[model samples]
Target chain A: SQQGEEDPQALSIQEGENATMNCSYKTSINNLQWYRQNSGRGLVHLILIRSNEREKHSGRLRVTLDTSKKSSSLLITASRAADTASYFCATEGETSGSRLTFGEGTQLTVNP
Target chain B: EPEVTQTPSHQVTQMGQEVILRCVPISNHLYFYWYRQILGQKVEFLVSFYNNEISEKSEIFDDQFSVERPDGSNFTLKIRSTKLEDSAMYFCASNRLARGYEQYFGPGTRLTVT
Candidate 1:
């Protein structure tokens, strides 16, 4: 299993606070993607950072990747109640084409 | 603002019965994929299709499971004999191309096998 593992399985924060989740993998990857799932709905693509890239940002979401450590982190700033959901980090292995192995995910709860 | 779409949002069937989950990927997308989540478990990749052929498949995709693009606009996943363990949320996703960065996912079909 080339899947990554996310740390801090669960998190809780107040509306205006920040939430940070970390993921660590064992193999070399071509790219890593972050997705958000709201309750029972499908996953929404949040961000993607390539192996060569160190940091990327999209609106309130910031992602950082460290190839040396084979780890990545997702930071959500000023979270809202609506941001409560599961966040997963998926890795595209160097040999896999369009195939993604997803982590267990981090359950986030933001209270307003 | 195109998105992937799936039919039969929820289906309940008895064990050993066959079920087909349908999905219409974003038009113009060249790569399609199927994934499933077993309730609280993490999402797992089942297979990926491209250029009218299967590009890759995981160990989970076995003889009991198959995928087809029976028409120009529809992609289907067929479970020949669904077991109680098959109960899960199946998601369909597609990207503009294999090199495309982001993948758009469908709302998913919830399968409940009794």
Candidate 2:
């Protein structure tokens, strides 16, 4: 299974602080994406970093991918209470045809 | 902004019964997919559909699970027989040909098999 695995199962941070979550996968990938799920609902796509790209940013969210290490990290800067949600990292396998495999997500809580 | 949409947000059925989850992907999207997540578990890929046929499927998409695009707009996943373990949140997703790697997911249907 070329599943991505997220580290730090849970985290709690005060509003305005930064929260970082890491993900590691076993195989090469075409692209890595970050998603946010609120209250166990459907996932909302946040950012996508292609294999050639090392870093990508959208608003307060930044994602860094290191293919050499088969790892990726998502950083939420100046997190507000609205940023509190489970963050997931999904990978589109290099050999697979556009199938996104998700990892166990990191539950983030922002205290206001 | 168009996104994937699914019908029957929640379903409760008895074990061994048949249930079909319906989805209508974004109008212009071509690729479609079905995925499920058991509670507290990672989201798992079930199947991917393209050109009116299945292109890829995971181990979890067994004989009991099947997907179909009956027309140009609707995509469906049918469970021939629901097992107690099949209870999970099922998500439908789709993407356009230009952006095949970036999928937009539906709200999902929560299946509770008794």
| Top-scoring candidate (lDDT) | 1
Q: Candidate 1 clashing pairs?
A: none
Q: lDDT tens digits, residues A1-112, model 1?
A: 6577998899999999999999999998999999999999999999999999999999999999999999999999999999999999999888878788899999999999
Candidate 2 stretches greater than 4 Å from native: B98-100
- Cα lDDT tens digits, model 1, B15-80, are 999999999999999899999999999899999999888899999999999999999999999999
lDDT by residue for model 2 over A58-97, one digit each (tens)? 9999999999999999999999999999999999988888
Worst 10 residues of 2 chain B by lDDT: B95-104
lDDT of 1 at B8: 94
Per-prediction DockQ, in order?
A: 0.78, 0.65
Q: Name the 10 consecutive residues with the lowest summed lDDT in model 1 chain B.
A: B95-104
* Candidate 1 RMSD computed on C-alpha atoms after optimal superposition onto the true structure: 1.0
Per DockQ, the best of the predicted structures is 1
User: Residue B7 of model 1: what lDDT?
Assistant: 90
* TM-score versus the correct structure, for each prediction: 0.98, 0.97
B1-114 per-residue lDDT for model 2 (tens digits): 898889899999999999999999999988999999999888999999999889999999999999999988999999999999999999999988723368889999999999
